[model samples]
Target: MKPLVWIVALAVLSYSTISGMVGHDHHVLIIAGATDGYLSPCGCVKPMSGGLRRRVTAIKQLSVPNMTTVIETGGFVKDSGRQDQMKAEAIAETMKLVKVAAINYGLEEARLGAGMAASLDRLSGEALVATGLGGGAIPVKKFKVSGPFLIGGIDPRIEQIGAALGSKLEPIDESVRALTDEAKESKLVPVLMTRGDLESAEAIAKKHPSLRLIVCSVKSSPYDAPRRVGDTLIVTPGEHAKYVVRIEWDGQAFTAYRFFDLGPEYADDKQAQEVYTAYLARVTSEDLLSMVPRSETDVFAGSAACAPCHAAEQRVWKASAHSKALATLEKEGHDRDPDCTGCHVVGLRSVNGFRSRAITPNLTDVGCESCHGPSKLHAMNPTKHKLAKVGKESCMPCHNTEHSPTFDFDAYWAKIKH
Candidate 1:
């Protein structure tokens, strides 16, 4: 009887020891990301909704105890210019400050043509990529929050790009099976991070229901709620840094999934602002706005050029925000910034439009020519001038939803209608 009691007591003690080794009281895994190059919110609209600085404040508040693992998936620069490169680098630095564990490359990052991706990876401390294909660690982190293992994958659609970045390609089902076996044997949790779509994730999930969670990168639409595919939960952080998935684990499995909406409620992190300002400074240094010779298509005949011909329209323009757009950038010290100035200036980077302050000084600010089309040929001879028509498509180049979210052609046109 005594021997049997001792054996039962020892078994109970062993169970307790194993559980302690595998679990913690409060293990939180912050599945954060920037799927596309929406590092900052579009300032075209007031009371801007999302920005990395505000997101930083939210992340800081959530990670109070330093018991969190942050991961950034793929995102790309809208413009591949030197200034944009600086912006991307600043984004990476900001991630580092929050102690992000890894970043997986997606189609956008791959589209950077390998060389640029490599440069970005280097500038980002190589922490930007966590590839298992090119001989990376099986489990990207050793944190016991969601067990001690993790796996990352790139989209097959960008396989060539992944290959260029040195990540090998393999069948998802096979990889999942083999990886899961390996993780199980090693006593590690298996989490799958992919740049693939929902269908691909579902297929993988059906075969490997044991996976802790599947983090999918989305573009067109973000998941409004978590969906269960097989025994795994497929989740994504909505686009544009609008929301971050805050997951809590009991060291066994996720206990709660809290997705916080980063809105006007959150304040900006001053430190992140410094990094962003530094990036803007780099843009100023590149001199991307240096004067260039205007081409034959039609030069930017500043709004003033049109004022002499159309006094009513000129009055409407001057009183409108479009006329003072460049001034606004000047107020923020971004007057010379290639990213902001392009949209604000008349044909700043358009076809044979405004080139620079040195040569096309008059082209500064959004002008009649910006929407009415380049009028160098027409301006010199108005009777000969002819515009086929004006349409919403023409205005969308700068007034699209991402930047000018509240833009309504009817309302905006009414404001500037001559």
Candidate 2:
């Protein structure tokens, strides 16, 4: 009887190993939405979630494979002091560190105007490639990876649509058809990360049955219902703003698993205030001045001038949320308003030439003093006088209800690459 039992156990083990009968045996991890510099303050709540450090830790722990492919849907661009170039630089650095597979450019990528966007693509390291479905495709050196995985990027618009009647309709059919053809020829699944609506995506998927997954970014919709059209899977990140979806292919079929924690929603009262207060203390006026080198007496040199002397600090500031604030405001059209211009501009009303009205200096753009308060006192002393240092309280003035939907420091910080 003991010999018979042993034989049966051996047979069972053999079957499990050969057949791959375990349901969850193939493990794959997919992480998305590290918007980084694009974050804003949610009501009174300070940023509590998302940053590169935490993200790196999370990825390190999950390094074991069945397989893992991390994809960012979009929104990697944000106005960082001079331009949106810093956002791309920061993203490239982070991707290099985290080893992300591919990224689709969001609508914000176009915010740096057309020329700057091209420059950003050039700056990102060779490991990452930027591809699009239509004429906007930028060629990158091919990267070799093992397994039956295919990563492709698609730009949302086919033709540039200016404000005009009947301009609403553009020819995206050809682009989708081309992408589908490419996928079928390569025997690889096609994933789309775009700013288009679900309805538009469903329409496109209808024509291209080979496109398996359509991951929508830029829109916040409910997640309970993941629309399936033909053989494609349509999903949006929803309220759990950032999410991870794991796709496993076993030489036969593909299965997906999604994991996300949106953190907490912004509350109007005390908790929000406390979080804001804490975040502000982290960066103050004195802190900003300290970041500038004492050797550089020209305080008006802007962010680029400070970069050479304080390489490490400049790297950190380049990745910070404050740097991108002006660009975000401008993109959102808040730059036109006086109320918003003050905070978004370096020195709005001060004699230190920090105001947006200083066109000759080109200080209208977001700069160091935007978060550090006025630099007048710090400039006067250079070394002796200390301006107000930023603290959690300092961040609240801008990060509160006036700016973002919800702010999680940890989540926001996790997205920053530098």
Candidate 3:
């Protein structure tokens, strides 16, 4: 009887595994609004969540045996310029590798301008599903993810102060209605993707109850399970590449939906790591950041110039890690790198700030100017350039959560205080 029971249990377990494999023969990953850049896990600080390497690794793991298609819902990278352009390129290439079925061009991509978007579209090949950029205004994109599975993106029009960074704003209601109608004609399971707030998403659902799944983009929040809204389901995988959301289809309804957290536990994919490392190398090599001309008003005054006025503070600064910020980068051979040099040195990106160790040796390191703002004027009139506030707002430029996750203003201030 005991032997029979053991055999029955084994059979049940085997059957379960087989059933799972069969059910998940075709898998689709919905990544929404990460605001993840190409060379991320920014700052390389420990306990970091996601990066390109981990994202690639997770995609590779999911692609085994099962047919996988990754649909990215934009907000690709935050911030702009040459570095952002490079990061977009990286995202396009990685999408090619992981076979990204579609991309809902988020605001970040739009900000790259139309010329760059067309270039990336050419690069993505067959992977870039649909032109999320519709006639005049556009929602992200709505594309076919093989079989009858379809994914669509919904993004608000950006026409406020910095409208040039965005495309024309199409009425959301009309766009969603049209896309859903198109998908329904082909008998496709249209899934809506968004990088907006919950209120906007709910409004869309209210208007178009036909959309059963809505993948959302969030900033600095934990992954939320699918929440039912009328007949539609809204879910977010959180920001950054911190998590990848997977949903399995049984040819009817979604059988399983789970998020794979990409943390330090997983080993990095060598190729993706090379991509990120190469980006780091390029930023350092090209010295692109140095091109940003500093203003005349914000001039750098050497840290030494301020030493006499605040002797005790200078002493504390000299003793603190901020004192040798450049040397730390130098040890890693990134001292000359713009990304490194900018934060490590005083006024590196400002008026008359550190240019290089050779050009502005006096300005190198997190000098008093870094915290107190550029002070060429202060040297002439010490009382005029007094800081208004020296709190979180002041330090976060470099000491942000991306750079120092463990940072606490009170505790850190205590250590470096005069």
Candidate 4:
């Protein structure tokens, strides 16, 4: 009886160890809309959201030992200029620190033109191992991970400009093929892909029946929520771009915990919308005004003008960094240099001795008109004339490093003391 008891105890201990090693369900963290290097209208000098620093911190907090995969769902370019390239480099540096697994190109990459896109791609490939539904260690076919997973890099959609520039786009199917082949040999499993190019993603799943795929795109519709399409778990982050899909892959099955970016609503308050609106108004007005002109033409007039009618917004802007960025440039002597003036002084042109007075009164500094196109008609009749907002591509002309090395998102935003 004693001998039999010992044998049973040993068997149970061995089983427990093995289960802890292999069958101990996996925890996968999926991050979407990682626009690290991209520029946004909220402020050109400093990005309001999706910067690399914040992302690194977020990833570190979420990382676990089992098997962690961090997937960056593209949209990383802000401008085509050298500064944008440097920003991409900065993003790459951040990725290295965070130990990201893969990255997918977003529409912004396409707008950067093929040359810039190729350059960024090369940089990322060199810096981090490309892993996705089709390119990394865990291939889409029969891939599995024990726990803690992070996958990166899977961009299929070419930006409109990149398409027009005749970039040889990578088909989704080919990318998936590469991903699956690599995964078969790697210890990691469970692949991730960005939004767009849904057709190719769908086709890949159809061809490979064993792989699990997670799709993330900006324009994702709620209708595609948590559905199984040919062995792929097509989960969309929905309207709230900031969300984490926590998945636990037990030995026999996979379960997921979806954390959506609903702001502070989890506290049971209906003020989420109001808080968001107010925060946006503050960030835009303060941060934006600081970088561009506020009263005189250039970048400041339009926003300033709009503020009178938008008194609430104007109050918010008064407390933001946009209203302070110009002063920082002045203190740094950036306003004196011709190269720096373009970005610092709003309407400061690249032409020799570009004077603010030479341009229209409204164009004296960085204002709404500088980005949103001419607002003269729209101002006259809030509805008759259409007001066109500036596209993401419009910011590159002055934001790139060709102007100055100090032109970074975090550093610039930090300068806004208010």
Q: Which candidate is the best by lDDT?
A: 3
Considering TM-score, which of the candidate structures 1 and 3 is the better prediction for this target? 1
lDDT of 2 by residue, 97-160 (tens): 5466665553455444445445644544333333432233332312213245555454465343
Cα deviation in Å at residue 167, candidate 4? 8.9
Reference-based TM-score, model 2:
0.52
lDDT per residue as tens, model 4, 1-418: 6743543454345334432443335555545444434321122333122233334444554456545555555555545544445445545545545455555555555455545545554545432222322232221211223243324345554345335455343455655565566566564454656555455556656776545756655443233246577667655544223333434455334554343332211222222223333433443334332333333332224455675565775565457544454555555433333324455443443222124433433344444444455454566667787665544455456556533335665564454321
The 10-residue segment with the lowest total lDDT in model 2: 161-170
Which pairs clash in the backbone of model 3?
Answer: 34-240, 132-140, 132-141
What TM-score does candidate 3 reach?
A: 0.77
Lowest-sum lDDT 10-residue window in model 3: 131-140
Ranking by lDDT: 3, 1, 2, 4
TM-score per candidate, in order?
0.81, 0.52, 0.77, 0.48
Best by TM-score: 1
Q: Model 2, stretches more than 4 Å misplaced?
A: 1-29, 34-36, 39-47, 78-83, 111-137, 140-146, 161-171, 238-241, 250-253, 262-399, 402-418
- Sorted on TM-score, highest at the top, how do the candidates line up? 1, 3, 2, 4
Residue range 15-75, candidate 1, lDDT tens digits: 3443333244556666667535566665676655567887788777666354567766656
Give residue 148's error in model 3 in angstroms. 3.8
Writing each residue's lDDT as its tens digit, candidate 3 over 201-265 gives 77778888888777766665544466677867777777776777766655666645666666665
What's the lDDT for residue 60 in model 1?
75
